[model samples]
Target: MEFMLDLAVSVVSLLVVGFYTWSLRGHFYSPKMATGAKLISAVVIATTLFFLYLAWYEHQVAWVQIVGLVIEICAAALFWWAVSASRKARLRFAFDPDHPDSIVTTGPYRYLRHPFYTSYLMFWSGWAIASSSTWAVVPVIAFVIIYVSAALGEEKKFSKSPLAPEYEAYRRKTGFLIPRFDQR
Candidate 1:
């Protein structure tokens, strides 16, 4: 019974995220340039399923689970920050071969070149931790690897567009996921 419930929850969550991602796809990818996007979608679904399995069958919940949940919350906050920042820049996902007219540099982007990816990673990591299964960590690591690869692939595509130089400059200044503090 619990397994069934978990499966249903996982499916519903995936559907919601899938639809949301599909809608945003137009803003980020060009026509016929969806291969990378599709790959990312697959990774997300697979990783979600992996986490669900672990949550259902693996380890006991512990204090660390709470820590993981907290981390997940922080990740959600970061995701919101990215979305809001993107909106402020008036940039929609190009979803085309061409880059958007504006390259965002404010808000979370000021700290990380890819806040959206970072947020997604954080969310996934938190979810894994919250599952409190020893195996849950595997999916989290896999998701990170896949996401990074996909991000780099997308970056390669974007590099040829007008926004390339600007993005490169931003990348040089910001960490990909971690924020840098001036120790000096």
Candidate 2:
């Protein structure tokens, strides 16, 4: 059962990466941004591979792995939803410095201003928790900083755009990473 859970964790991690990559199809990014994105993607994939190694060779508690698996599943679903919703919006690479052409408020975007970053953090946090080692936290913290910086950069761009008024309204209704339950 434990082995099965570990395998599932790895499988889901890979599937999420595929989903993310598919979402980038046909989107043009600057050379520098593309390079940065590829580097970040490689690092994230390497981290998942490391977790897979630990799961298969090292001892991890079954229940903790189960919890992490559940979180991973949630992250995957959220990411898919965000991707689907933003498909028409032409998603941009992180730290692109380009103004958004549209404001997406449907699907996961309705609840979170940065659903992609939220899902990314959830996946990283899930894998770290699944590892069931205090050392796993180092990567999680690093990812948190990276995603937060990207999200803040995007937010700053939005604030400076002509859509600032519209974005400000959406920002108030949506949470940064968590959903605002009282946002009616």
Candidate 3:
């Protein structure tokens, strides 16, 4: 019964991510992009799936699973919010030093420059916790490195856009992957 429950949770969680990602298909414009960024994005997907699979296969502590669920839900919510807000910017999912249609500074972007990446971070960390394996840390750390690289690379892309000045100011004032509590 416990196994069945874990399986169900895993299925639902994966479906949510899969379906949402699918829906984003043509929403983000794909300009001529960095090959390395594409590779990193692929790595993000691979690492995420591996960690999530581990989450279900490994024995999960009840409290940890609950905490994971909470974090995952929060992350999903933020993703949705960020996506909704990004529509105005013609948000693309990849890194293109030439593809800054607009610099989004409202909604989720107001608090964190990379709310989308934050969601990914939360989602993976939650999955790792849900896995309840100390070994899960490996993939979690990898995800962090990959996501940070992509985020920073994307920011560099933005710096080349028409909004470079504003983007620079935003970058200085906003947090990278987390909210800047220091903002006054």
Candidate 4:
């Protein structure tokens, strides 16, 4: 019964992610959005949720739970920051993937090349650690690989734009997912 409930939760989470991604498809990368990528994300989320359920059932230590909570909070903050930055950039400046517009240098983009993906990774990593189950780690690893691949692909596509040179310089200075506090 517990397994079934967990599975349901996993499915629901995947559906939510899928819907969100679908809604943002055209605004970001390839207007069509890759079906394969979406499917992969769904599988990864499902797997992670399953492992999370197992971990929850096992009952980890209090300290681990607290650490997990902190990580999750950080992840949420990062995600929110990324979204806000994106919105500001969209409003203040124009970005047309089809037309190849200017690169986004403000907001979170000023620090991390891929703030959204970074936040997502942090969230998943925290979830895996919180679960502290070997099974949970599997999905986290898979999610990292998938996200990295997608980011690389997006970068390649974005490189064709006129702002490619500027973006390249930004990429050289900033970390892929994590922001460097010491560097201005």
The best candidate in terms of TM-score: 2
Clashing pairs in 4: none
Model 4 off-target regions past 4 Å? 1-30, 88-102, 182-184
How far out, in Å, is residue 45 in model 2?
A: 2.8
Summarize candidate 4's per-residue lDDT along 69-148 as a digit string, tens digits: 56756776776666666653431111223433546666777788777778667766776666656667777788788778
Give the C-alpha miss distance for residue 178 in model 4, angstroms: 1.9
lDDT values for all models: 0.64, 0.81, 0.73, 0.60
| Candidate number that wins on lDDT, 1 or 2 | 2
Q: lDDT value for candidate 3?
A: 0.73
TM-score of each: 0.72, 0.91, 0.84, 0.74
Whichever of 2 and 4 has more lDDT, that candidate is: 2
Among the numbered candidates, top lDDT falls to: 2
In angstroms, the error of model 2 at 19 is 1.7
After the best TM-score superposition of candidate 3, give how far the Cα of residue 56 lies from its true spot, in angstroms.
4.2
Off by over 4 Å in 1: 1-33, 88-100, 181-184
Write the number of the candidate with greater TM-score, choosing between 1 and 4.
Answer: 4
